[model samples]
Target: MTHRVLAAMIKHETNGFNRTPTTLRDFRDQNFHLGEAIPRVYRGTNLEMGGFLAAAEREGWELIPAVAASATSSGPSTDEAFEALCMPLTNTIRAAGRLDGVLLGLHGSMVTASHDDAEGEILRRVRELVGSDIPVVVTLDPHSNVTPEMAARATAIVAFRTSPHTDQAETAERAAAILARTLRGEVRPRVVLARRPMLTGFDGARTHHAHGPMPDALRRARALEAEDPGVLCVSIHSGFSRSDCRAVGPSVAVTGDGEDPRFRSIAESFMDECWARRGETTERVLSVAEGIAAAREWRPGEKPVVLGDYGDAPGGGAYGDGTAILSALIEAGIPGAVVANIWDPAVAAQAVAAGAGATIRVSLGGKHDPEHGGGPVEGTARVVAVSEGSFVFKGRYGTGTRGHYGPSAALEIGGVTAIVTTKNKGIYDLEQLRIFGIEPTAQSVLAVKCMHGHRAEYEPISSRCLDVDSGGITSGDPLLFPWQRVVRPIWPLDPVEGGTP
Candidate 1:
């Protein structure tokens, strides 16, 4: 019998504190393709959907494309937006008769207006449509908040082991392979999950440092998978702390070949590792002033000095409108520097309307959360270049996947060139700047709005990169945010039994 499998993707990372509600337009601006368009856009690409296509071809299963939609991380998705995005996936499953299996590409840290555990809700809906008999497999980012409901609904789950997430396609292939084997009557898979009471851990999932706590835990996870035939896959999630949900923290999920008590034990053992190293961090955060000083003092030889504007990163769901770094750079009169993007839609539109070569007085960035990252920079901007802000990723991360910055322009102000963008996207690929007429490789200093994802592409072209905790919602420290929904007595937040962190 020829097996039929359905594959779909709807990935988003929500920042609960962001007042801006993520909408359908946001998905469209990034990458939204339904039905045949999904395969057309993603085929042979580095995205997870590309892996799904390859798996189906390898397994000789009839591939059914549902939808492929993803948005750069931002505020919690609106109810209407969430429903619209999920409808295509659920609808495809509802109509896919005699479906043998389902493969999903998802980010585990998604939070919507109606659902905190958005991945769980998606699985629940899929289970409702397909019933429990059909094997379902999911691919996730390492920064997912692994909820109990997600484990209960899916047969098997896999996550990207790399922090820079250069292994998206590889991770998807792993999950799809499991689904194919299940359909072929090779194995019965079930996911068992375990988590500690901490709000965040695993050095925020940074695998750049090979000997870090995350890497150590992953080694053990891989060892467990190799040792036991029953262990299908072991996923260690560092969790996304920007989300204000009960399940918003580090976790371990062990996908066992069948029901067994050992799966939980294996998961718990991994969770123990996560708990023990809850206070660890991967990056040395620098103040805005210090970061600016470093950039000013850069003696450019081979590569540019990159400063990670981490606190206001769009990747971690911050507004990305923080002016702290840009302001400091301007104040220091740093030359040959470019800030890839400042997410101020209005200012971007204004610049585009004025066209290139037009000089205009503008209040740049810090409009969203002025209190956090130095309330806006006021200056006369010379519009050097303007663009519709669309390009394809050319780096190790998301290669060939198309992205849009909406309306964008390179505004030269106070000896600094700031790329003002209507849409917010983290700099995973150098093309994000190159397309906007700002070649990062030739610049003296580059201020990128991302945490770890940028490392894959940007680090090679940088003399040194420093994480700048130029304040916003997505700052490195989870301790800074006011707790509300997370389960109490969590380590690093509350006293661990009788001891302190």
Candidate 2:
């Protein structure tokens, strides 16, 4: 008999320091597809929704798609946006005559205005409607803050082992397979979690680092599953520390065959490793001046030096309206440099109005909070190109996915071209530049507003990549933000002995 399943994607990575409140419109600006539109938008994409769709076809399950809504990282999500994401699933669960299993795609770090542990809240509601007997398996981002509530509610949980998250679809497939096996009575998986009192760890979950903590942890996790028949899946969440929630730190969840004492032991061991390697970090974030000097040193004939605006990473809930690096480039007169992008809808509008080749003086970026990534830079620029700012992803990070930056314009100032956008989203794919007629290989410097995800695509084309501390909400240093919500005595926040205190 074919099993009936309910599937949905509700995801967010809240950055507590950001002032912007995420709303439904924000989800629409990034990814929002309800009912049938879910398949239309994400049937073959590289997201969790795509994996669920594939599972339905492969397993002969009656897949019920409810809603897939994910807003870019920002301050706490509004109650309304949270409701919009949960209601579709709840409404569908209420109406669906029966559901054999539930497959969810969640970013384990959602902090809404009403609830700090938002994904836990989503699972709580799901359990409320479905009860505990039915199987519920979830796939989470590697950066999720895996709470006890999430581990308790979920029958099985899996997270991307890869940091650039190149394995999003693969991670969901693993969760779906576990659900399938449980429904078939092949296994009875139960999840157990263990976390340490730390703000961050696991080398920021960078799988690209061959000797990083994540690679070592993931190797051990995979070995556990291979050696032990009781272990179904092991998920290691490095946690989103930018989200000032109590559970905002590294955790490990083991989905075992049954209620085995060994599952908790496995999770505890993993957490111990995380705590032991709390101080190990692979990337070094340099100051704005250092990034500018690197850009200035680049020659015209060499591969572009990718200057990363680490602090103002949009993917980590930064406002993305930073002018620190842009200002530096202008000050140093670094010719043949490109900044893609600086989020400023107002200046983008002005560029769109002025049209290509029209010179206009405008203040760009740092509109959200001048105290963070520097105030706006006032300058005259020639509009080189203007676009609707929508494109398809060709990078390994988000292959087969569609992305939009809203109205965007290529403005040339002091020989440096800036891609100004109406909406803020991290730039990971080279298609972002190709859309504006800027080839990634041709530029002397490609300063991007991104965190680590860009390493997947940009690193190959870049001669060298340097992390820049522009002082936005996504700064690598956790001490940069004012902390009030996260549990006290956490690592880097207060002095804590090893492991759970």
Candidate 3:
């Protein structure tokens, strides 16, 4: 029996605080890979689409292709635009008649003009169209807000466990395989989620290195999974609290059936551990000086130390224009370095105009909000390489997902090289540089704008990495931002003295 499975990707992570609404232009500006334009291999890596195709091939199923639309992180999507995006897919699903299963790639943290729980809304509508019999499995970003509506509406949800989300394709493969297993009656899928009260700041929730409580919880999950046969998947979702929603904060979810009490017990155990470890997570980050010093002192090793500048990640709806870290690096005169994805198109154009090897004075970064990091700094730079930013990768998770760097170029100021792109990407892959003739392995210092996932690839080559204290929309200091509705009473925000509420 050759079953038919429909697959599509619609993703947008909305930072409600950001004034810039996610529009069609924003999507086009930030490397919108729509329909067939999506890369066969994105930035030297294969993408989730490859995983779906692989799974379908194994199952002897016919995979129906629909539109896959992904925009960079931005403010809330306009209601009209979101509806327009959803209707086409929804209408397609409605008209498709009976389908065996559906697969969707979604960023779980999307908050649009129409709904706070955009993924949930999508799933709920899809559920209405597909009914109870047809199963729907979704692959999500680890930072997604796991709402009850989403949990109830979808049959199974698999997400990238890593924060920088290096495991996008791996998680997609897991979801697709799981969906196939469910459809084949090999395993009955069930989801039991345990909720925690405390809310964590973005920086404190990283799963890599000696990161927040999530890593320890993941260890516990591994142990529990070994003991319980019914536990198919254990997801420790450190909820994206930036979008003020009811299902905020960290949660533990177990997907399986046959043992309700056991599932609840395990879920609660992990949830309790998350709450216990919340006090250890802090927002008092190291200064840029501290970061530079730490990076210099790190000894050469098998795994490079990864410094995550979560504060200035453009993926979190940041302007990606901060100059604080660059200034610090320039002052330190660190050699053999590359700080990627500075997001200065004008500077890129100026460099392009100057032609390769030509020396030109260009303004770099700080165009979005100069007040945060003192805006752009003018410097004499040489164009090192100009590229279309093409590469293929079987990602760190080993899922063979293709990624992209769009139209990218590299600029050198002093000894440091900076990658300027027309697109805003949060994750840093080797292909991003390798495609442009810049090899990261040759560099002593690698500064990238990402929260955590950088550890998978960049960590292997780094001498030392430090989460540089920088300023942008995703600043690690949660206290700096004023929130009207975040379900607070945690960390520096509450000032309870006990650390986390």
Q: Which candidate is the best by TM-score?
A: 2
Better of 1 and 3 by lDDT: 1
Each model's RMSD to truth, in Å? 1.7, 1.1, 3.8
Clashes of each: 0, 2, 23
Off by over 4 Å in 1: 498-501
lDDT of 3: 0.70
After superposing all C-alphas onto the true structure, candidate 1 shows an RMSD in angstroms of: 1.7
Cα lDDT tens digits for candidate 1, 333-435:
8689899789999999999999999999999998888987768889899999999999988889888878888889999999899999988888889998887
User: Which pairs clash in model 1?
Assistant: none
Which of the two candidates, 1 or 3, achieves a greater TM-score against the reference? 1
Per-residue lDDT, model 3, residue 79, is 82
Count: clashes, candidate 3: 23
- Alpha-carbon lDDT, every model: 0.87, 0.89, 0.70
Q: After superposition, how far is residue 471 of candidate 1 from its true place, in Å?
A: 0.8
lDDT by residue (tens digit), candidate 2, 1-501: 879999999989999888889998999778888888888888877889999999888999999998898888999999998998889999999999888999999999999999999999999999999999999899999899999999999999999988688888888889999999999999999999999888888877878777778999999989988999889999998888999988899889999998989888889988888888788877778999888877777887889999988999999999999888888888888778899899999999999999999999998888888888899888899999999999999888868888888888999987789999988989889999998999988999999988888888998898898889999889887767899899988888888976755
